[model samples]
Target: MKISPSELISVLAQFNPWWRGGHIAGLPAWKRAAWHELNQWVTQPPVHRAVLLSGARQVGKTTLLLQCIEDLLQQGVPAANILYVTFDHPMLKLGGIDAVLAAWREREPRAEGIEYLFLDEAQFIRDWGTWVKHQIDFVKDRRIVFTGSATPLLEADQESGVGRWHAIRITTLSFYEYLHIKQLALPELPPLRSLRHLFDWTAPDFYRVTELAAPYTGHFHEYLVRGGFPQTAQIESVAQAQRLLREDIIDKVLKRDMTALFGVRRILDLEHTFLYLCMHDGGLLDMTDLCSNLQVKRPTAQHFIELLEATHLIYRLPPFGYGKDVLRARYKVYLADAAISSAVLLKGKNILDDPTALGVATETAVFRHLFARYYAQQVRFTYWRGKQEREVDVVAEVGGQIVPFEVKYRTQHTGVRELKGLMELCQQKNISRGYVVTKALDDFGLLAGTPEGINIMRLPAPLLCYWMGEAELHGVVE
Candidate 1:
């Protein structure tokens, strides 16, 4: 059945509402939650030659891209001027970039500044970079934005989009966006702790604002135990939610993504390894132990972990290499998102036994929130494990200087001495600040340093998460 180009256009024309896009895209409406980022992308003209958006399964990449298309159309671009295609749809893959343009040719050739092509699940297209480049060669004035869950991770064909893509890695909603989904106003994060020490300085209005958020604690707990995947928030039954998280997101990543992208064959073993990592998501992982438990060779475990990482399912920390004393095999492992761990490892009251698991989930959520804000700038963040045994939960570059952070679930505490070794490393590197973020305190409780001007500020965790969402990781640098 050789299809003519006109036939192809007609087939695509049936999905024409998708071409109307945004409100017209005949799917779920764009979640109001993602407006901030979409607005940022929309308001700013394309800086990179093309924008590449990535995220976990069904994180609204298509809807967001459609809204982005609406923004383009509103800017005076006409419908025929734009090409829309599903480069990859898990259910039935169709319409690669070239095929999209080919179908469009049946209608008419692109008129200047009129044609914009959006390729959803772009990585599925064979030689996609070449296809788009071919378009760019002829249509010198054009726009091409791609949407995919698995970030191509700097691996694109040389034919078209080299040094051209500004990567926008979409993620599950942060607490900030979640609030927006509920139409709540929590634009700023409060002080870290609710300590009485700061009460004397607070005004009555401040207390009222703090009181307004009392309900969030319950939802926040639910978010921690169940996970932060968007659909997880919609499902009323926690059990059903967890099932979707495991079957749909987790397995989809392992089976479809890992195998399709990385050629992974021992997928069951990889699933087992992932379960092991989820159960031990926050523990200090020694890679050799993983090999022993999974009954695989050490290198096999390492390779599996690398694949897990490449697909954005797992994250590993280097033993903060400041001293010659740390073991190469002792880096800690964290699942990329807390919900992934919560989807599998958390059940009923069992989550409370290791209540710190909530903190782990929160930390992973925070890391992901912050990671997206910094990833494009080449900021490498990892954990710190000093030779002398002190540790920090997260580390990142601030104004080209490294900063150490410690995350705590403590409700009535101020602690940072534990990150002493990491702070020393910060001082050695002339880093700006050492921070201990927690839930208990409303104000930053300064930690006394080792008399060498090694500053430690026990600050609020929610503030950091909020700031990251606004792309303000650079805001608190010093």
Candidate 2:
């Protein structure tokens, strides 16, 4: 169903006669702090053909696009010039693309000007990327932005000669972005060399945690458990938050979005498998063992895992393969958001109390939280392991350098024994600095460098800023 450019505007005009619906459509005010990517996107000179945004579930793709659409329409692009389609609604039978153009033509039967096209959950239309390419070639005057979490919509554009597509990957709100929403951190700040270090896991030991007890520790702890997905931030009741994310989010990913994208059957088995994953949320993969548990062939189990990964509901972090990379070690798997892990179980404290399940959960939580914040630029985060019996929890490389860090439950000290092992690992890998980030401090902020240069820091899980890399301090440091 191909919609002519004129028809797209008319259909959209019904939804927003004055280009005012998205902002005034009884929608929640966009809450996350300035997404660093979008901040860079809107200002940077546009290069790729179409601006494409993709990400995990509930990362606010639809919300952000609506916000951008409202602004562009108000800026005076002809309503018809802007083409908006969503595979979720406007069913393919009713009008789909062709119907959209009919509506646009009805609205402004005879008008011609610069046009914009915006789409939501775009994977519904068959071959939407190729369809989009056809439309793009036909209408040289339109600017398009499409949002979808499915790998199809995300990957299709890349496959179909996507030379003109500008890609954006949205992710759940970060701890820093959450703080921004609560109005906890100021929008701008003076040049502070210490602030940047405080944000990284390998933060210099300059700040402390007791400094935050007066008004913030409890708040931060709650964030640690629930994560900063948009709905979690708005819902005050813990139980309500859990229910919403499970039915509305996780279910949608497994049933609606993923099924449509991957064309999967045996969804119930997949559901069971996912629940098993929730139970072992951050555990490493063992196909033979998982096959016995799921009563499926190893290939089937592997297929299920990869399918979960394809739609972003889950991710498998490959073990830090030493350069020899013998047989590429098994990966540790985790849900993309911690909120899911927290929601799937009734015992909130289980993650901390049960060491086996909890360690992986805690590690998974930190990876998602930190990766969600800076996976794009100025950061190259990877896990580490070697043939030797040592491992560093998180290893990040920035500006051609490596920073290794270990996560420990005790905050009262750096747990030197744990770090002593990591220090050896770091030296072996030629990575610098072994950091122990913990909950043992009595201050509201970070701890700077220890005298020996192995940056040690005590940090409460949720509130510490994530100014990662030197973006937080442009020229003062890097």
Candidate 3:
């Protein structure tokens, strides 16, 4: 059942409606925060490398590609010169990339100038990395951009694609991006260059910022439960949104992509492991206990975890320390989005009523923001555990400086005793500043009567996420 060139051209025509003199429809009016970087790379690449836009399923990678096509069209690029095709489509999969290209060249022989190829879900193509490398090395006046749902696109061909392509990860929406996607109206605050910039602010300045951020506080719990997927951001019903997330994001990755890409045979075992991680999200992982409980071997459980991470369903954080200390530590596990936990567990809006669940979800959200903000800067995120079981939730290593953050998202007053881990880490590391994310807006300020030299800011979780998201959008860093 081979697809002919004509049949492939028919499919391509359907995908690329602009070739028929129709506009690219269904484009989102508001672009993602990643759009700026991606657009720049596509239009004016710093290097002559192709762009690989990678992320989990349903994070709007396809939409971003379509938006890029629209931008190219607006710039007076001939519609036929811009090709858009997805290997996910069965027809395209049958024909492969070669057939599609052959058909395009045959049909558009007279077309000239730069050609843009937008390939979606490119991992389905066999030896895609080598194909792209050949194109980059041999082809001229051709700019290629591809999207992948899994990291195999990266892991499988790192050596070959070392300098041939630039990878840009499109994570689940940040709180600020989520708010914009939801079209919520709120007051505009002054730009924040970095989280560290807040430490230098006076009491009046901090309060004024917090007051301006008051409207965002009400949406924090919602964002945590709904997660950051653009599709679910505007869904009014919590149950419906979680249902979509579970079916679209979790189920597809576990059932289909794992089997197709990674040759995973025991989907039930993978599902069980993911559920266990959801229950213990933001907690340290014990593979022994997990294997014993799931009645699986150590290697099998380890394989499942790796496959999950590859699919971008989970993130593993190693403990922060030097040499053997880091190697000997058990890693902490977190779902890419807090809403994944909520969706898988069917926690819905009730998650807010459960304080323990609320705390774990908040910590997951905080880590997501931190990872999104600093991943490009080569920041290493790890947790710290000390004697008597004192642990800082997240310890970020930026340029050899240790910045510790602890989450205290409880309604009660946060006393100095509660910030023991952050304070201890700051003192031991001689770190001048740290942050304790709290639940109340009134908790926003500097900790008083401290250890003199060390300073800790008690910021609300909403404000922290919002500001971090905003700062990342603006490419603001210290």
Scored by TM-score, the top model is 3
RMSDs, each prediction?
4.7, 4.6, 1.3
Candidate numbers sorted by lDDT from highest down: 3, 1, 2
lDDT of 2 by residue, 1-478 (tens): 6656454555565555444333336455543333344434433425536666777677787777666656666666555455556657654324566566567556655347656566777666666777777766776665666767546665666766466565666666665556555656433322235424555532233332344233543544556566657777667777777778788888888887657778788888888788878877766677777778888887777888887887777877665545547245777677877667767766564455565544455566567655544554557666666545566677667666676656664435554554555666665766544455555444323334333445444444433334431232132233
Q: What is the C-alpha lDDT of each candidate?
A: 0.64, 0.60, 0.88
TM-score of each: 0.82, 0.82, 0.98
Q: Which candidate is the best by lDDT?
A: 3
Compose the digit string of candidate 3's lDDT tens values, residues 1-478.
Answer: 8888888888888888888799877778988878888999989888788898888998889999999999999999988799998999999988999999999877666377799999999999989878888989888689999998547886778777888988888889999999888888898877778777788888899789878888877798999988899888888988889999999888999999998888888999999999999889999999999999999999999889988887788899999887987887799998899898878988798889999999999999999999999888899999998767889999999997888999999998677899777777887889898889999888888888679898888989998898889887777767
Of candidates 3 and 2, the better by TM-score: 3
Between prediction 1 and prediction 2, which has the larger lDDT? Answer: 1
Error of 2 at 186 (Å): 11
Q: Which is better, 2 or 3, measured by lDDT?
A: 3
Cα deviation in Å at residue 310, candidate 3?
0.8
Question: What's the lDDT for residue 13 in model 1?
Answer: 65
